[model samples]
Structures are given as structure tokens and as C-alpha cells.
Target: MLQTRVIIILLIVLNIFHETTAYIFDVNYSYKYSTKKTVYSSVFLQQNKKDFRFLAGAPKTDNILICNTTVCKSFAFSSQNEAGFEMLGAAIAAGNTVGDPTYICAPHYIVLPSFRINGRCFALHENFKPIYSLDNRLQQVKAYNGSYEFYYAQGQVGFSAKYVEDNEFLLGAPGVLSWKGTVIKHTDLNIKNILQPEKVAEKNSYLGYAIEFGEYYFGGRKRRCAIGGAPRGDNLLGQVSLI
Candidate 1:
């Protein structure tokens, strides 16, 4: 009886080995974790070669539908075209999808140069920040949707950031340059459950014509710095798109 059991175990092991090695290896990937899975290889026209997608191995033959996940409820906003405190307010008040263009140039901080329009080294007017969804919002305020996602803010994985600042070692001033003016924010988001999801009322625009103005001043002004006439918002307006 023990000899029979050993023979059966050996046959099982060999069957498993045969099934595993039947796969045709591709030079692109050799995944031990993912095998025999279907991956969409048709590239999106808007995507670059860097965005190619492929299964680690063979596509599974199936007669029935099977999926590991369901598409999460979502809203894909084209982003608002306004800037400054208005942008933040609109996002909070009109909960849907928000997306801001390149915020690196958004008027975040400002430094005064050798000149000023009126008084103070630099003058700031629009720093008005209304309470919203971050840790700073009102006590009763919540995200109004699904609980916070652990993987959503996982440190810039899907997208990449490019630094446009000048080389730090080769600078004329003592410290880095500071700038300020207006700031804009927009994003794309999805409600976890659409059936009973939070309903954001139908509105023309959340935060429109919003503007923020601020300034920065340091001790003395050997070097002058100011960031005015920054690029205005575009592609946001009332153009809302669904993903």
C-alpha cells in the first residue's frame, strides 16, 4: 500500500511539471507569479511605447467569463479652468472628478524683487483657503464616498514627475527661488458604489473664476524674483468627460 501511494504522488508531481513547462517563454517577461493570463496587447493610441501592456505568459483558454476585479465607480473630470482659492472651494463643494494641470507652475509661493506695487517688500491678497477634504476640513466633513484607499496614494507609481528647476549647484542667489500668485487644482475620481453613491448635484461649474494672490519677502533684496503672468487655465472649463 505504501508503494502504491508513492507511485501516485510521483505521477501527480509529473503531471504538474508537464503543465507548467508547456508554456512558450517570451523574451519580454519571465514572471513566476503570473502565468497563463490574458493581457490586452492592443496599444492605446494616446499611449507611448513605454505604456505597453502584455500578459507574462499564455492566455488562459476559457468557456466562462472570469475576472479578478470589477471596475470601481469613478468620475473622470476634464478639470476646471479656474485658479486660486476658488479651485479648492469648487472641488470640496462639488464632489465629483477634479484634475489640475501641471501645478509646478501654479502660483504656490512668491518672493519679492527690488520693486513693489504699493507697500511691503511684497504684497499678498488672495491666500483664502476654505476648509475641504484633507485633515484641515470641518469636523463633520468626510470624503463622502468609499473609505480611504490604501493603494491610491502609493507615491507616484502610475505617473512620473519631471523637475524643471535650474541646477542647484549653479545658482547666483543664496537660496532657491520662491514664487507665488494663483493656484489651481483639478482631479479625476470615482465613487466606490454607483447605485448608492454620494450624489453631487448638477452644477455648471464647481469653482469658476476663482483667483488667489500671494507674495513672499526675504531679508534684503540683492537678487530680485517674481512669478507673474503665469499661464492661465485651459482644457478645463465646463468640459467634463467620463472614463
Candidate 2:
């Protein structure tokens, strides 16, 4: 019996490997201790990448699907549009099938010059527009959505910061710089600098955030820092100080 079980497990492992490896791109990502199985390869003209899907769900009910190319849910044949992607994400989140393709899409907020250790920077405005502001010697840009506002600053100090609308979350700033008009009510804010600005941040001098949520292929295949708040809402909200 023991020998039989061992052989069965080995076979299953080999089968999974074979199935996944059969595709041109295979990436096993871990989210919240759960592994996301992605297997496929195609080009998303918008993203210019091979097919890839981020699956979220249990084995049998594995319904949540996020694919870049024509792999999992085809919102439109050979078209990886934002509307389709948002529909797919919402469908999975609501545990429902694809609905009206014209449904109001949710904006994926990304404050560039990301606060994540080694992330990109941008000068987005409150309305998601790209605007530039200079103060004395410090210059900054901002972008905002329903939940948070993000900024990228350069001059005496260089860093990124966020102001979230969620309650009980706050990121205090050091006395090094002024926060005269950047503060938002009932929001958490934090800032960090680009580890290597010259390479990644400097490359994209745009004032707005990237439209997609995937790895940043620029600078030779570097992954973009993760946006959004805590995975589980229960996680503690901590602050990062510049001092």
C-alpha cells in the first residue's frame, strides 16, 4: 500500500510538471501561501508579451482568471483590452460569469515611483493626469483614484508616497520635506526612493502610471513592484519614515 501511494504521488507530480512545461511560458506564483498555476504563451499587443494567466481559486472551482493573451477567458478574440481584463477580474471577485462588456470598469491604481523597494516613479495628477509641480527646489507629481493618491518627488530629496482613504492606516512623513497641500483625509501615506532611479525610474519620465498590471519588461525584464494594500484586509498598516 505504501509503495503504491508513493508511485501514485510521483506520477501525479510528473504529470503536473509535464502539463505545465508543455507551454512556452510556465510560472508558478505564490499568493497568500497558495500557489497559482499559470501555463500558456501568446502575445498581448497592448502588453507585447506571451500568453500568461493568474489563477485564483480552489482546484475544482478555480474560476478567477487573469490572462494577458488568448488563453483562459477570451473577453474578446485576440484582444487584451482593459474593459475585458476588468470584467474578468470583477467576475472572479464576485464569483460570477462575464457580464456586460460595457460595465463600468474599476481603475487599477498605481502610484509610480512606487514605494515598494526598487519600484518605478512617475508624476501623475489627482485626476490621473500627468502634471508637474515645482516648489523651491523640490519638484513633484501626483495621481489619484477612489482609494489613494500617489506622488513622486525630485530635488533636494527623491521618493514616492501614498495617501490612502482606508481608515486606520497612516504613513507619517519626516520633517525633511513639507506636506503643505499633499495630505488627504482618512488616508495612509508612505514614501520610498528608487533603489536605482537612473535605470528604471529615469527611463519612464511620464507623469502618469502604466495602464497595465504586469511585470515591467523595460530595463531587461524587471518585474514591477506590487501595488494595492495588504492582501488580506486584516493585516496591520504600518508606516515608513524617511528619517
Candidate 3:
């Protein structure tokens, strides 16, 4: 099951005609949540209030590490803004001084240690290209090229990896939501569940993985959603869906 808490902070009004296609210029944060037995979680969020932008994500695993009980493992695929400046991989590899070193460039150019303990876990991958300009933005702040974070407790834990495609971003740099459009109009269309297959599931044979889950929260709270696409393969990409 999934639990969501949405708080609207302010008000907003559109500045153009209905014809202006909505555009997300910048993003503050996007996150996912999940649990163990359920197997998958379908999550979505949107900016019902003014100023906020459409930002949402699906929990990559069945365990919600925030509980601190069951272990969690999963991977995510994403990209940073092609026009933004972001650090590649060195930062993540810096936090821990544990494990022995080993490297590989096949699937992706990455380096991992042979063994690691808590406070010593680490994995490195490219973040995205530079997100901000060196001359104008680098001096003010520094962000990762992209981020791939893994969470676990002990005993048994899963895995997680996310790829942030350069142009697969929606929010604007820092303050701007989008150079395109910020205002939103709600549609009765439901969100796409990330944990379930787009097609219906059948007995004995299922798509992806199996999970038991449910959601907690009612219309009393607010939600958000975004539209995007993933690369299918062979130079072809998939259709755009709400994230």
C-alpha cells in the first residue's frame, strides 16, 4: 500500500490563454515509496497549488526503507536536463571509505568495492551533463550530474539503480517550474501505476513482478503527476506517460 500527504502552500493564476501548452521548467524534488509483500507501488503527484510543478515517481522496490525493518532493493532509470550542469559520479563514491575497490565499464562505467559495511556502501554512475553553466551557475551551487541511491538495513536487502537521462527532466533550474507552462487543469484521467503492467495481469503468468499493495489517503489531500517517456531500445523510445 502507499501513503501520501499533500499540503498546498500558496495560490496561483495562469498568465495566458488555454492554448499555452503546460511546461515544467524546474523541479525541487521527486520521490518514490513502497513496501515488501506488495512487490510494487504506483505513485503520482501534481502541483494543485500555484508555484509548485508536476513532480512524481514510483517506488522502485516493495520495501519502504523509511520503516527501518525490511530490506529494500530496486533500480530506477532517469536522466537530467540536457541543458543543465550536473556532476557525474565521483561524489557518491566519496561518502564511504569502506569496501575494497573493483571497476567495470561494460553495462555502465562504474566502480564498486569488494566488501562494505553500513556507512561504507557506495556505487558510482554518471549523473548527467553539466546542469548549470560554469561561469554563471557553477559558482552559486553544485548538483549531481544525476543521482542513483540504494537503501538497505542488514540481513537481507535488495538493490536500486536509477538513470537520469539528460533531457528527461521537467522542473526548471531552481525557481522556475518550466519555460513552457506552469498552470495546471485537472483531468479525470487516472495516473499510470508504475508497479503494474500497462496491460492486465493473468493468473500463473504476470508481467514484471508480483506485489501486494494498497493506498491510504483520501480527497482531503492533494496529489500531482507529470508526462514523459522512456527509451524503448534500438534507437527507439516509448510513448510518453504521466509520472
Across 1-243, the per-residue lDDT of candidate 3 in tens digits comes to 122222221111233433254655333553334434443322212122233221112222111111112333333333222322111221111111112121100111112231211111122223322221112222122222253212111101001112122212121111111110111111124211242221221211211111111233447764344432222311332233333
Best lDDT among the predictions, by candidate number: 2
Which model is ahead, 1 or 3, in terms of TM-score?
3
Error of 2 at 213 (Å): 18
TM-score of each: 0.13, 0.18, 0.16
**Per-residue CA lDDT of candidate 2, range 149-185, in tens?**
2233322111223322222111111111112111111
Write one digit per residue (lDDT tens) for candidate 1, span 1-243: 999999999999999999989978875764232224433211101122343211111111211111112311111122222221111101111111122111111111111241111100000011222111111113112233355321111111101111112210000000101111111122223212111112212211221122222233567544323221222212223322111
Q: For candidate 2, what is the lDDT? A: 0.25
C-alpha lDDT of all candidate models, in order: 0.20, 0.25, 0.21
**Root-mean-square deviation of Cα positions for candidate 2 versus the true structure, in angstroms:** 17.8
Residue 176 in candidate 3 has what lDDT?
A: 11
Residue 22 CA displacement from its true place in model 3, Å: 20
Q: Which segments of candidate 1 are over 4 A away from where they belong?
A: 1-14, 17-243
Candidate 3 least-lDDT 10 residues: 172-181
Native-to-model Cα distance after best TM-score fit, residue 145 in candidate 3, in Å: 34
Question: Regarding lDDT, does 2 or 3 come out ahead?
Answer: 2
